[model samples]
Target chain A: MNLEILGYSFIQKGLIAGTAIAIICSLMGMFLVLRRYSLFGDALSHMAFGGISLGLFTGIYPLWTAFIVSVLGALGITKLRKSTKISGDAAIAVLLVSGLGIGVLLISATGGFKVDLFSFLFGSILLISTEDMLLILGISSGIIATLVALRKQLLHLTFDEEQAQVSGINTDKLNYVFVVLASITVITSMRLVGILLISALIVLPNITAIMFGKGFKKTIALSVSMSVISVVSGIILSYYLDLAPSGTIVMISVAMLVGTLLFKYVNVLGKSHVIQKLTSEA
Target chain B: MNVLEVSDVSIKYNGHLAVDKINFNVKEGDLLGIVGPNGAGKTTLFKAIIGLQNHSGKIKLFGYDEADYQPLLPLIGYVSQKVSFEPNFPATVSEVVSMGLIPEKKLRKGAVLLKNCGYSWNLLYKKVGKDSDKVLECLKTAGLESLKDRRIGDLSGGELQRVFIAKALVKDPVLLILDEPVTGVDADAQNKFYTVLRKINTENKITIVWSSHDLEAISKLANRVACMNRKLFFHGEKEEFFSNKELLKTYAESAMQMHMHDHN
Candidate 1:
């Protein structure tokens, strides 16, 4: 591909926006994986659709509306997890379905909407604007700053809530904060990957990182790197192949996960002899 | 003075009473053992004392009722029954130990708190940073110094239990509460763990309360025993409770059966 094709202002904005979303989602994905709340990402992404529809109905900025709605969904999930006997997965399912249902109703009520909902469903790189790129950057920076400030508390809480509480961490508050951050990341990433595929950006890279990374910090770094590679590659492939960016990105992430798994398997097989010898000695 | 006093405390879960009308007092240097069946209220009682569960009646820690003595939490160290840490959580054994020091906020500089807990400086340095000396001492005390750099998720069941103990001990708590501290450990590790507990209790004069299903082990280690099965079935000296055949039959029938089966 020529530099002009890649360097077009619109394409450049799309790439920047995609990169920012990739970083935020990957970093936040680590926490979601650790806390075993990966599905919460999916739930909030769907819930953001409702917020987007509501924003359209109210003539408000959909991004801000989506952010607020996602936060509300996050808070709802947190509250439901604590106050009810429902499992996290069950709660997520309920919230996801209800939000999607509300979103469909609201979108139907809007007559001759300018933006096609299908574009947001599978994502449209062509829709990237300067404003959207700036929003992505802002959300990315916010996630990084919040994670840094609460790194210690988050680490402790993720490991053991009872211990964290005993150690003077306000676990209840931190839980809300973590989920809220996750909601915001979902909203931001939805612009690039769409509601249907956003969670892949949040889950796939983190899972791949977990298989190979040594520790928490390394896992996060590796996840971000993998996300960046996948998103950038996916965008290029989408452009050349005339495919949806969302589908391409998710497929690439899945491929990377499979590659990482195979690599781990081969490494484990190579180390089996040493492990067997050690076990026999023991 | 009694460091902890509980009166008519009851805890319910989803309409089922896990602990009903339990009462006890813990004094300085006291080793109180709580024993019961799987569904018994032993663990629930510990949770209630730590303010992890809402319950009826009153719990006084350091002479203040639990409701009003939120500040007293810093003086108490708790080790839960289940060690369900995030498997991929990024924390070394030393960092896990330092979690116990959180309540203290600002630990005294160059203090031997970690040393007393059993971690050394070298192991601490390998885990987080130079400031992890206290954490290393805690690991050493818990007999996990060599594994200081190891992530918490990689630890064995027995090793993880000890890590929690080390975390608790690093606080130099006035009272230490452990829930089923040796549920999955081998017999040998269990004995060693009890020895460590006894040593800590004797040497530091720290009051200790631990729950276990092993009546024989409880008899050996605990100076006082509290039998809880949704309520206080019995609470007194270990020998006295053991010698009371009727009370032992009612309080620890399963443990007694296991004891007889072992002898046979």
Candidate 2:
């Protein structure tokens, strides 16, 4: 491994921004996965594509438009699920298809900004400007602060929403707040892992950590560690291999999940073997 | 003295009235059982009293009006019917119980939550922590001290119920509300659950308002019973509720309707 590869300015930027996005997305993902909204992340990211296209067509900053559209999309999904007969997954499906269609139409309408569209669709982490790094840091800190301040209330609502409401939690307001935060989280993370693989960052680490049966705090800690390892290592490896950074990161996350499952299986088999040996000796 | 005063409370869901003009008063330390068929508004009445749903009319707890009930929520613990969570929620018995103390500590004591949840205070000297002794006491009272570190999902239905009871008791609530807590529990587990609730009510002197469809259990355990089918049918002593043939018939009819709906 060439240690000097880390000396590149783009590499440094990618590492810093990617690390920040990884931490927040992993934390946010734990709740999303637990609440069974794993696919919502994917849906929102796709919707963010449409937002990006709209931004391009209107000659505005794409990320800012994405931030708005994704938040609105998240809130819309929540409201639709609650108000109509549409289930959560169904709502996500509707949004996912519509988002892609709109993205395609806007891209064509804008005379095909292929280079810009490609950069957004698949993340161009190497092209992350200093301002993007600052934005990522600011958003990550805000998300972290909000989660810390409302940790207990969020836990109550996550574990038992009805009981939380009964305990005087403003559940309706909290739901909106949470979804908006999550939407912002999804949008910010797209720069590091791209629209396609953003949900992987949001889901894979937490699900892997859950397989270990640790308590909530421990699970969260483990997930964050896993996410950091995946992001940092994937960034380094992709630099060395000259591959797509987002794909590399998502693949590493998937690998980590599979590794945990295999380890659990092995552990179970080893325990059963030990039990059998003890019985024979007796 | 009445601990819970609910008067002329009505709830409508999607423009259909679920609980209509319901009025019931539960005295301190009374074990009041609410029995009704599905969609009979027993749950709605409970929801209204606990401030989970919007309703017309008034509810007073400890003589305080509805608007002021938020501060007193820690004093009122509720367990909803068929409460389900993520199978791998990653909460231990102690951790889940600690959540009950958050509202209390946040509202009254303004103490750092790490202590209230039973983390060692030595790690953070300046942070005022929850009293570990009080948490253990609540766990002991609910017979869940032995399972404090065990994951809640690993426990049996009866054990989980006890953990929830301990969770509620951690706040030192004067009132405990349970909705069909034993509905899916095994027969032996159900009996044990009732025995635990009886202890909590009679020995600890905590007023309990539980909703169930178990007529026999209500007759055996509750001092007072309320029957309902959207509107309040009867609310009185257990003997009167059971002995009144007309009320019993109404309850039976509601149960029959529920069974028919299930079949359909």
lDDT of 1 by residue, A1-282 (tens): 655658778778888889988998888888888888888888997888888888887889776887888898779878988997789789899879978887888888886345556666667765878887887798789888999888878887888888878766778999988888888888778778888988899899998988773666667788899999999988888888898888999999999999988998989897998899999999
Residue A216's C-alpha lDDT in candidate 1? 67
Q: Score the docking of each candidate (DockQ).
A: 0.41, 0.55
In the predicted model 2, the residue pairs found to clash are B115-B130, B116-B130
Q: How does model 1 score on DockQ?
A: 0.41
Off by over 4 Å in 2: A274-282, B10-17, B56-58, B64-74, B104-133, B239-257, B260-264
**Which whole-number lDDT from 0 to 100 does residue A235 have in model 2?**
93
Give model 2's docking category.
medium
What are the C-alpha RMSDs, in order, of all predicted structures?
5.4, 5.3
Q: What lDDT tens digits, residue by residue, belong to model 2 across residues A151-259? A: 8888888999887776667888999999998889989998887888889999999999988887888899999999999999999999889999899999999999999
Off by over 4 Å in 1: A1-8, A111-116, A125-127, A236-243, A273-282, B86-91, B103-131, B242-246, B254-264
Per-residue lDDT of candidate 2, residues B1-264 (tens digit): 667898998999878999989899998779999998988888778877776689999998766687765666645778776669988998788888877764444445312322343322121111325556666777887777888888878889888887788777766566789988887788988887888888888777778999998999999889999888888889999999999998899789879989899899
Question: How many clashes show up per model?
Answer: 10, 2
Candidate 1: TM of chain A?
0.90
